[model samples]
Target: MFRHTKATDLLNSGVPIHVGMRYMGHKSANMFMHYAQTLSKTHEAEFLRYRKITTDGREYQQDPHEMYEAIALSKRTDRVLPHGYCTLPPRQTCDKGNACLTCTKFVTDESFEPVLRQQMEATDGLIAERQEAHEARFGEPMSQENIWLKGRFQEKNALSKILHTISAVRTSDGTFTPLRGAGSPQGRQEEN
Candidate 1:
């Protein structure tokens, strides 16, 4: 994990992958490439920095506290799932074993759409690459990697369906209106 994190951080900070591979003492590019999975937290921070919504040519500035408050408030609800939300008891383990997107306990709102989309795109790319490798090695038939990727693809597809059903209105002030419905408990509370 440390090696992967360091490699990811180095590459994200503008170091070339070849240089990173050399620095990490990796002789095979394929071996080093496995560490290149992007961290969603880092990706989200970068996305937030550059993608602030604008109103009438003015960017809406989100206070750090406001962001923290939003996340904290959401965390208080059992409706919020590990991947999205859960209707189960807050302290109870998921009976479905964390299969969140398709589980009845899972809920999602527009606020999480960007992260879900990012994850979906990443999973799609990963599945394609794994499928290609599996085909090359085995000359057809599903491999364990392919099966895992298929499960991930299905989960992301379910999440995307949830995202599509969410209703978001972009206000003139540049903020998105909170969504309302089964997966949207975040909409019921005011951000502090």
Candidate 2:
């Protein structure tokens, strides 16, 4: 247990895997990887340390306790979704990858709007470049790759629209307040 914890801690602390393996006297990467696996709770704690949230036009590290409370509340209220938390059972599988923008299980709050918009812009740029290349290669009709890009762009556009519509209410004193109630559909038009 000590060795495993030490290995995981070292890796999580940004130590190179090869260095860790050397320190641990491991002969192969397989054994080193086994020791490097972090417990879920430990991983969550590490993730929270680096999590940043923008509030009141300033960025701040999220309070882990508050984040835990929010997650717990969201779970109890069935507000957890794919991108965030969702009502899905723990054992259920939703085979989505990092394509959260196209997942029907995705949920986003006002805090995530800026990131969503950024993603939309990036996707649009990629689609434009890919479309240009496709047109040069196959002039008359859209190629399969171009068609796929259009579909993904549409999905991202829809998500961006939904995020644009959900703004956090601001008080007279300039404090941002989250919307009341559990998570809303925000955007869930596609599945993984």
Local accuracy of candidate 1 as per-residue lDDT tens digits, 36-147: 7655554334333322222112223444234333444334554444344344544566666656655654445445657767877877787788788878898995665556
Best by lDDT: 1
TM-scores of all candidate predictions against the true structure: 0.43, 0.44
Cα lDDT of model 1 overall? 0.55
lDDT (tens digit, per residue) of candidate 2 on 1-192: 999899988877656568989999998888898889765555454434322322112223344455555556424544443334332344566575555545554444454555666766777787778778877887854565556866776666666555444432434774344222112122232221
Q: What is the C-alpha RMSD of each candidate to the true structure, in Å?
A: 14.7, 13.3
Error of 2 at 166 (Å): 2.2
